[model samples]
Target: MGGIVLVNVPTSKPLPIMTDTLQPMLRMLWFLLHGILPLAAEATYLIATYYSDDVCSSSYAYQVHAVDVVNCTSLTCSNGEMSSTSRSGDVESTECSTDYVANMTSTLSDSSYIIVLRFEDNNCSTLYYGYGTTELGECVENKYQGGYSISTLNKDGSADLEHFTDSSCSVAYASETANSSAVATHECSSSKYVWYTGSAQEFASNSNGDAGTSFSSDGDVGTSSLGSSHNMNRGGEYDFPPPSRDSSSSDARALTLVSVVFSCIVFVLVAVIIVLYRRLNRQTPVETRSGLWDDDTITATRIPRTKISIKKLLCRGAFGEVYSGVFNRQQVAVKMLLPATRSNLQHVNEFLTEAKMTAMMDHPHIVYYVGVAWDSLSDLCVVLEFMEGGDLRTLLNKYEAERHPVGIDRQKATIALHICHALTYLHSLSSPVIHRDLKSRNVLLNHSMTAKLTDFGISRERLDRTMTAGVGTSLWMAPEVMLGERYGVKADIFSLGVVLSELDVHTLPYAQVKKQCRETEGPRARLWS
Candidate 1:
């Protein structure tokens, strides 16, 4: 060098003075050649267009490149040769012939997108492999081995990715995220994936491959076809069809109606049974002995023995003694056979006949029969209504003692009318009855002063114009009955006349005859003789 000044270079130090500068220049050159140049050469910007149908109709767009993919429509690729006609008439292409599709950069569009690779032709109707994202690189690796035809991508992406082992993508072995790129090698090895949005994703398997059946997510739960139309929301929910009413529902309604009707019928039947039970209980008869003398004689009504209470003696007779009593809370007169008379069949018969006769008589002027009671260990008593006003004989005696008139014709007529009425009721029967003995002592008066005929001890029912000869009081007896002749109902009228006379006279009939009687008189001369 002619004009340059030279300094001594230290060889051992390897030109330490220029090492920093040269090293930097070489490092920058190497970085440019190794990093930037290769990046520029390998980088490819690709726009992928997808179609819902075949032949690239109804297409939407997605993008892909060498470094990463935005949206991948197909698995197959060439060197910038794979192209599809987009909606905007823009022809976008990618080179994936020598590389796996997932190795390329992908960008999904605002609209959903799916990748469907076909084996027969460019149309997606033939054998195919479906995928949701390019992360599944296995789908591209097996592309040639499986004979792919055409590849198409859907504009609407799926919410979930279902992977199937068959070409139809029906039999699902795995479920994955829609944006996942990891390979499903276990249950989904060599499987296809189908992207669904608003439809339910169900898998069906066959020996050939798994097939996909699509149903609206809102549809009834059962096997359904993917071809059914449904609306998909942004959240990937599907609005499915409503379910139909089947025979099972109808049968349930019918059963409910029948049950209600049966319940109503049962309720009505139970109510009716209850009402009948109450009615029968009310009508049930009290248990008591039927007849005092004869078991075959049944009374219309019977009073239990517990219902009678002896109060006081009311009167006495040869056949029985009458006592005031209480029966069923009402004052009553009870006539019981005397001990002395019990052994006499005639007196017992007379007492029983009185009860039987009064039991059937319903006249207002007749004493009412109130059934019978057991007065003592050996005595059976006949019960009758109590006469608070006593008998006509007592009333007449009270008038005589007070120096009042023995009888007013008006009072006598009223008493006579009542007695007549009682006799009429007894005689008007199909067979007339004759009261052999009638007198003031045998007539009773109620609290209201209404006269009632009583003392039916010797009464007889006359079938024809005849009567028993030996039954009558000597004073009240009809002339024919005193002669021991057969009599008729008129005998009772003759006895009634004597009762009226006694009421007027205020004394017993034939008082002189009774006073003059002596033991020496012959029995017939003292009476009918």
Candidate 2:
């Protein structure tokens, strides 16, 4: 029998055992025939074969026997077992090896496209240990495994590469981007693992067949590559330094300090402003007093001292002088109490009472009380709407100067009617007002010759329709008022009648009474009567 030979065995099953006498004979027969037959190839080799797309399925396939690799145009081998050939045509192969690596690069016969494939096992069953590509710069399969078997597809161009020690690509050990025909290896000092340990190792390449390095865990290394000047140490270890902080960190710290300092300065300025405002408010005294009238009554407005500008003296009386002033840029009549009147508490109270009462009245025929103010010396001042036509007394005097007889009876009737309207409005109030003093002088005329009742100095709120004492011009006073009896709105009616007489007759009330007393030549009892 030809030399007993052991061949094609399966590792998953148990091997058949031979007797001691048979084993010696088989050993002797193998020694005798070893020189005669070609020595069995000790190392595994890669052979490229040809097939159609339907046979390969774009995946690695293997055969138990040697394949006719000469029919294939492209091939790659490890440990110098086989050599590479020029890649051309659609050279596909299903033959593969389980104990060695397979690398193939081929151009399609139908198109100008090229394909690259790498396998880790001879049978090419485990896809996790292989790499394949149809485009350049595109990711290679099974790149998570640290490997260095990267090359150009036809020596087209150079590539840049970086080797990371960790799966996350956070720890880089070597980097380069040069076209290398020979395989390059790298070792990590931290792990003591060689990056090119496996025959199936490969690097990602660009469209120009230039191999490059990837730094991210997802294998997107970007287009740009590192310089080829960087050396990839073979078997030697290298330490990767930690990242260092730049000047930007110092600039950020400086900016933070400036912001804090500026904020502190602003806080100090605000605090100072608040203190000054409080101090100024304290230094300025309050110029107004509240509760001058009943709670339910309309209150008078208080005018600031600076707002009143006395232009000239309009008139003067025993109580005070009236001055023409500009209040809030509008012409106003300001009546200031005399020093003598200010000295008397009764007169001062009466002045304030007049202001309060006038302010409450809203009738058109009643003079509008603008506001009240106080001088620097604390003297009371009352402001009223300026009547351009002056008082009825002045109007009558002008008529007499012009010899116009004060127009027709209609003019007198109108004046009387306006006065009556004002009186009616006062009496109709919830707290009826009593105008104790009613005369031609107290009736003011505006530019339109409209009559407005004024001078509320002696006016009082009379809800009971009675008063204890008589108060008014004696000539206009009624007989019952002169007798000091309790009177009511009837007293104001009597004053209104006297005012109407003055308007119609164009003469003062009881002017004839003074003349009669002066001309009296009879008994004293007649003068009394």
Candidate 3:
């Protein structure tokens, strides 16, 4: 009866029609807000959190439900986010569960709030969740809920069961997932364990031994764990931080103080030593001569000065040419290195090495290295103790020509003894030395026929036993050396034995059927044994 009595309706749409239109429009806006806007908001939050440190720490709290609270015990915070410390005794209401993760994060926003929480169960395990600030709001949740079947688990990959859902619902919350799931897991019978990162102090103690108690105060994020009892002794378990100061400024001060103290002590000690040394030295006899001809410089084994000068050339080798000279106004032999071939590294190194090694070895039995002179632009000159008798090979040749012969047995034994002593000294050096080129020419004799081992032109300290080099004269080379074997000190011993045989027999060990040196040869190059 009321519908029949209704007056003619206006041409405009009914109020219910307008209401329906607004309902659908509102729903579209709701879709944009709850679905699209929420997704866009989450994306922006992540971007903002990544660039900021405080936001990073705050974001981690949303991953778990309420657990972090004041004076936190059993609560965990990572990257700075926290949770409500108090537990919900019995969370039986499903309506409450809808916002369980949300309420937890909202409570952790306070600076004074220290405690955080995590969830774990027999069938399904829940982990820590934290909150981040959104552009639309300050503290916001980043979680959802779903469950995954344990049977569908992958072997090579891993899954994080962040949130659970009713049978009607589908998946877990994105906010609850870790930034990285690739972290290595150690397997137990029914579970895999992951490392729970700890504070900077704890991390430093565990990460490296050198970390020690010395630490920086920058508050960099770090991770370390405690496996033993909570109140256990920290002796070896944890590393405590050292005293803090401005490192750069404090270090400079410490270094300056140490330097000043050291310098003062050194100056006093040196002054005292100098005074004592001068007093002691003055008491001794004053030698009129101070140059190379002094008794200290020239020994009884030294040869007399020769009349010949640098105008006449004595001889020449691949690296150097020898001439006579007056060193410290006393007659001496000078060997001058030739300008090397531009591409010849071996020749250059050999020349420089010989001068350095000879200068270091100051012995009467060894050839005297009087002085060395060189510049970047010029070739090097090495001054030596003049050999009046010349080389052994030359003396032997002269004896053969003349009717009068030298005393062979006595001369040989003297040379042998002197060489053995020199070799022993070189072998016992801190770094064992090797005379790679051992030949008759390198064996020099004074007027008295006492041999002075000379020419370390190609010598090198045996860094280890084996060197990646093929060195030594062909005639005097040992079996191992000739074959380019990884020879040791034994190789030198073998070479020395060959030299002894040569001196006795005046012939090579392999002279009967000498094998021509070839590129490819085995360790058994010579069968002298």
Top candidate on lDDT is 2
* Top TM-score hit: 2
How many clashing residue pairs are found in candidate 1? 35
TM values, all candidates: 0.41, 0.42, 0.37
Worst 10 residues of 2 by lDDT: 78-87
Write the residue-wise lDDT of candidate 2 on 184-301 in tens digits: 2222212121111111122222223443542222232222222142333232111212112245655655565556545654654564555455555655434444455332332337
lDDT-superior candidate, 1 or 2? 2
lDDT of each: 0.50, 0.51, 0.44
Worst 10 residues of 1 by lDDT: 180-189
lDDT of 1 by residue, 1-529 (tens): 2532546665765643245444554454445435433322322222333322233322222322221222223432222212111223323333332222332212232222333322232221222322332222122211212211112222222233333323323222334333212111111213332232211232122112434443333322122333224433332333322121245554655565556545654654564455455555765534565354553332444467778888766555434677888987889998887543454566655666677777877889998887865534346678898999998877876776687676547877888899999999888988777777777878999988899988887787886668657676666888888888878888888888778777777666665353355234542122211
| TM-score ranking of the models | 2, 1, 3
**Per-residue CA lDDT of candidate 3, range 278-394, in tens?**
555665434466333233323322333332244434664444667777755677887765332212455544555566678778667788887655433244456788888887656
Model 2 CA deviation exceeding 4 Å by range: 1-300, 375-377, 406-408, 516-529
The Cα error of candidate 3 at residue 287, in Å, is: 43
lDDT of 1 at 151: 21
* Model 2, residue pairs in steric clash: 97-122, 97-123, 98-122, 98-123, 159-177, 160-177, 161-176, 161-213, 162-213
Question: What is the overall TM-score of model 2 with all chains considered together?
Answer: 0.42
* lDDT score, candidate 3, position 482: 79
